[model samples]
Target: MFIEYLTNLLGTVYKVPGTIDPEKSFLELEVDSLSLAELGAQLADDLGIEVAEEDLSSTTTVAELAGLLESRGADIPA
Candidate 1:
């Protein structure tokens, strides 16, 4: 669920094209630090999950980010 949300957010909010592979690192996806920080802000606003930009940056892949959100109790829809 989080994967889907992250993918949609990346594509819609960040203007990322094509399918986002969960296993791929953000560096591989060409997502810059500024974009990751924006994405963290979006997650806080939209999902009520307070994620630090550094925490998001530390995550290596989309899947890891999803796991972090889940660990933080984000209500990701199935």
Candidate 2:
């Protein structure tokens, strides 16, 4: 499910690069900051939530972002 979100966020076919856990840095996967922001907005839209602009800078992992969305009451897609 998470991987699907990432793929949609990046608009590409993203495979887990290694055994890297979701909590690890997206930098480890080489996702750039601009892409990450786009990901955040896409996530917000998909989940029907508003992700603040400031939060985008520090959301550095898939799990972290997911947690933020969850906290905002997003029904994370399974």
Candidate 3:
């Protein structure tokens, strides 16, 4: 669930340099802050949950992000 969303968002940003790894930190991806903010909004709207920009900023990996979404009642797919 979350991985698909993250992947698509990163793909749209045009700055993600390589194949995305769920375990890789967002810092490694080097996604611009503007893109991250936009992604945070999209995530909230798409998932029908409140995804804080700060939370997104501090997150370490795509998997951890999925976990956060699940914690917030996102019903992430296994």
> Per-prediction TM-score, please?
0.87, 0.63, 0.75
lDDT of 2 at 30: 75
- Candidate 2, residues 1-78, lDDT tens digits: the string is 554465454445344445556666677667667766776677676777877766655436767666777677777655
Which candidate wins on lDDT?
1
- Where model 1 places Cα greater than 4 Å from the true spot, the runs are none
Against the true structure, candidate 3 reaches a TM-score of 0.75
TM-score of 2: 0.63
Judged by whole-model lDDT over C-alpha atoms, candidate 3 comes out at 0.73
Clashing pairs in 1: none
- Model 3 deviation from the true structure expressed as Cα RMSD, one decimal place: 3.1
lDDT (10s digit) by residue, model 1, range 1-78 = 889989888889888789999998888888988898888887887888898766777347999999999888899644
Best candidate, TM-score: 1
